[model samples]
Target: MIELRNVGLKYGDKEILKNVSLTVRDNTIKAILGPSGVGKSTILKLMLGLIKPNKGQVIVDGTDITNMKEASLYSIRRKMGMVFQGNALFDSLTISQNLGFFLRENMKLPEEEIERRVEEQIQFAGLEGYEDQLPESLSGGMRRRVAIGRALIFKPHMILFDEPTAGLDPVSSKKILSLISSLRHNNNLGAVIVTHIIDDVFNVADCVAVLYQGEIIFDDVTEKLHNAQHPFIRSILSDKILEL
Candidate 1:
């Protein structure tokens, strides 16, 4: 499980998060919902220990990682996979190379094992025939799938997604959402999805935490969001999508 205990952060006098607390259990999907520039992505970075909070603690799988050294955090970080908003694929590498790149770079596994893992991810992502293609040639949804496959190649216990469906068409968005739902059922992997789209939250998240003005205004099961009495939550429930 991952827990953030009263976390706070400041960036050159501008506060980003303030006494924010959250918990994400294993084998479930949690969505962090908020408007643009509301520090939703910052929470993901805190969970990964990529940035240090000015106050509070970040616990991942029973380890206090808030003050842990970079070297020590490596193993802890490997337990979770991150998919960036931009789909961060190497344009020069083919799909197979992209999927197997980390394993080959980080592990001393044999060539055969790397190939096996790469093939497995290809099948899992439903991109079997596109294995030899570059990311640029595929559609936006396909590229996202490739990015997700690359993340899953690590076989992490949990995945962190930054705007997973931000730029996709409606059809593509549905496909991505379906794929995310399948992860919990098929792979038993936990996920934390950071998004501004309300429908996305309803489609995939089992629980949600609503961030606003650097504070979490609401945290509970997805269904309870509609009943939340907070004005922000009520506003978002009516707005459906938080572009502002």
Candidate 2:
């Protein structure tokens, strides 16, 4: 499980998150929903120990990582995989190389094992024949799938997604959402998806935490979101997509 206890952050004189608290259990999908520039992605950085909060604690699994050293945090961070908004694939490398790159760089596993893992991710991501192609040749949705496969190659306990469906056609968005849902049911993996799209939340998240003005205004099961009385929540419910 991951828990943020009254977390707060600041950039120079500007505050980003304030008294924000949330918990994500295993084998479930949780979404951090908010408008653009509201520091939604900052929360993922905190969970990974990439940044420290000015106040409060970030607990991952059972360890309190708020003040942990970078070296110590390495082991902790490996427990979760992160898929950035941009697919972040190496444009020069083939799809298979991209999937196996991290294992080759970070682990001392044998060549055979690396190949096995890479093949597994290719099949999982449904990219069997495209393994030899560069990311640039694939469509936006295919690139996103490759990114997700790369993340899952680590076999992390949980996955963190930053705007998983941000720039895709409606069919592509639906496919990505289906892929995320399958992670929990088929792989027994938990996920934290940070998105502004309301339909994306309803499609995949089991629970959600609504962030606004650096504070979490609502946190509960996805169904309860419709019952939230906050004006921002009401406005978002009506808008469906938070372009703000």
Candidate 3:
């Protein structure tokens, strides 16, 4: 489980997040909704320990990880994977090499073991034929899949996704959404998805947290989100339906 307690972040008085609190249970997908520049990405960075929050604590599985040393944080990150907005695959690396590089370099595993793990991740993301291909050669959706493949290669217990379906066509977005949902259900990897896509909440989330401005406006079970009577949520949901 992941817990944020009274978490706040600031950048020289320009606050990015304020008094934020949220809890994400294990073996479930937590769908986060918010507009761009509203600290959604910042929250992920905080959880990853990339940046420190000015106040409060970040707890994962009962550990108050707010002030953990870098060594411990590095080990903790082994159980976490983050997928960025642009897929973030290294342009010069082959798909298989991209996924296998970390395992080979970081774990210093044997060549055969690396090969086996890479093959498994390739099959896991259904990118069997594209192992030798570069990111530039694949479509946008395929690039994201490769990114997902790399994340899965580590067998993370916690997965953080940033805008998994931003700017894609509806069909592609839906397919990616299904992949995320399937991962948690099939692999028991906890997922935290930060996206603006309303359809995504319904399709992929077990719980949803809404952030407005610099604060967490609502956090609840997916089925119970609409019961909060949040004016902003209602507006967003209404607008999303109209777009459909």
Candidate 4:
């Protein structure tokens, strides 16, 4: 489980988040919705302990990681995985290498163990035959799957996705969404998805939180999001103008 309690952040004179509180329960997907530069990604960084909150606590499992030492935070981070928006794969490395890199370099696991874990993750991502292929040689959807596999290699308790379906075609997007839903249901995984795609939220998210002007204006089950009459929420959801 992940919880942000009255979190606030500032950079010089700019405030990115103000009194933001969010909870991602086990076996659930919480989608954070907002336009660009609204600090959606900042919340993920806070949860990962990549950055500190000026006036709040980021609790994961049972530990408050907000002020944890770097050494202590490393242990906490190992329990979480982050999938970046750009698919963040190394073009020079093959799929297997990419999946096993951290386990090999950081965990110092034996070759057989690394190979076993790599193969398992590859199969889980449905990339059985693409193990030796480089990221550049695969389709966009395949590359995205590799990125997901990399995150899943360690079997983290929680995963953070930054725009998982940003540039995929409809078919690929739906496949990724289904994968996320299955991960939550089958593995009892917890996830926080930061996205501007309303359809993505409606399709896979159990809960939705709307962030506007650095504050969350709406937070509840996905079904009740449309009931919000706030201008920012209404403007973003309206299909006629399609501001988002």
Candidate 5:
């Protein structure tokens, strides 16, 4: 589990977030919904210990990692995996190579174990035959699946998705949502999904948090978001503001 308590952050004189609080609990999918430039990605960074909150605490599992040393963050980070928006795959590397990249680079596991883990994730992602294919050869959704498989190589208890279904057709988008739902239900992995699409939230999220002007205007279960009374949240639900 991860929780942010009254967290605040700034870049120069611009305030990115102020007194924002949220939580991602075990066996649940929490979607952070907001428009572009609303600091959605920033929250993910804080959770990963890539950035520190200027004023509050970021608790991961049971540890407050807000002020943890960079060296000490490795252990905490290994428990979580992040699927970047761009997929961020090495185009030159095959699917298997991409999934095993970090294991070979950071982990001292034996070659056989690494191969076993890579194959395991390949099957998990439903990309068995594509293991030898390069990123350029796969479709957009396939690439995203590869990105997710790579993240799962270490079997992290929690996964963070940054716009998981951002640029894809409707069918592709739904497939990604189904995959996320399966990952949560079958694998029992907690997730925090950052997205602007309302459909994405409804499709896979168990809970929702609306971020606007650096503050969360609404936070509750997904079903409640449809009946939200807040002006901004109502606008979002009505599609008056599509992005948030």
Candidate 6:
């Protein structure tokens, strides 16, 4: 489990996260929802150790990693897998090569074993015929799938998703949501999904947390978000984020 205890981060006079506390249980999906610029993405950075909190502890499992040394942090981050906006696939590498790239660089696995895992990952993403295809050759949704496959190739303990459906049409977005749901159900992976789309919350999330001015104003099950007492959350649900 990942737990943030009264965490706070600031840049000069602006606090990016304020007394933020939440728990993401193991084998569950936690969705962070808020308007743009509310520092939703910053939470992912803090958890990944890309950034540090000014106050409070970031505890994962039984260890407090808030102030771990950089060298040690790399080992911790190795357990994390991130799927960013736009997929971030390598331009030149084919799907299998992309999935195998990190394994070859970091693990020193034998060629045949890498080949086997690569094959499994490609199939895991439901990309059977696109093993040799480069990112440019695949559709947007397919590229996202390949990115997910690459992230999961290491069998990561936790996954981070930043706007996994951004810039895609409705159909493509739905497919990505389904893929995430499938991953959570099948692999029991812990996921932190940062998104503004409430549909994503209702569709894929086990719990929803709303960021308001760098603070979590609402953190509860998705079914409770629409009825929260917070004005900010009420306004968001009432307007359907069209006002965002």
Give lDDT tens digits, candidate 1, residues 1-244.
Answer: 9999999999999999999999999999999999999899899999999999999999999999999999899889889999989999999999999999999988789999999999998888889899999999999999999999999989999999999999899999999999999999999999999999999999999999999999999999999998899988888789898865
What's the ranking of the predictions by lDDT, best on top?
A: 2, 1, 5, 4, 6, 3
Residues 8-58, model 3: lDDT tens digits: 888897988889999888888998888777888888877888888899999
Root mean square deviation (Cα) for candidate 3: 1.9
Q: Which model, 3 or 5, shows the larger lDDT?
A: 5
What are the per-model C-alpha RMSD values against the true structure?
A: 1.0, 1.0, 1.9, 1.7, 1.5, 1.7
Error of 3 at 43 (Å): 1.0
- Worst 10 contiguous positions by lDDT, candidate 1: 235-244
Cα lDDT, model 5, residue 149: 90
Which sections of candidate 6 miss by over 4 Å? 242-244
lDDT of 4 by residue, 2-108 (tens): 99999999989999999999998877899999887889999999999999999989999988999999888988888988898888898899999999988887797
> Global lDDT of each model?
0.94, 0.95, 0.85, 0.89, 0.92, 0.86
TM-score of 3: 0.94
Which residue pairs come into collision in candidate 4?
none
**Off by more than 4 A, model 5:** none
Cα-based TM-score, every candidate: 0.97, 0.97, 0.94, 0.94, 0.95, 0.93
Candidate 6's residue-wise lDDT over 43-130, tens digit each? Answer: 9888888888999999877688999988888777778888877788889998888999989988878999999999988777779998
TM-score between model 2 and native: 0.97
Worst 10 residues of 5 by lDDT: 235-244
- Cα shift from native, residue 155, model 2 (Å): 1.0
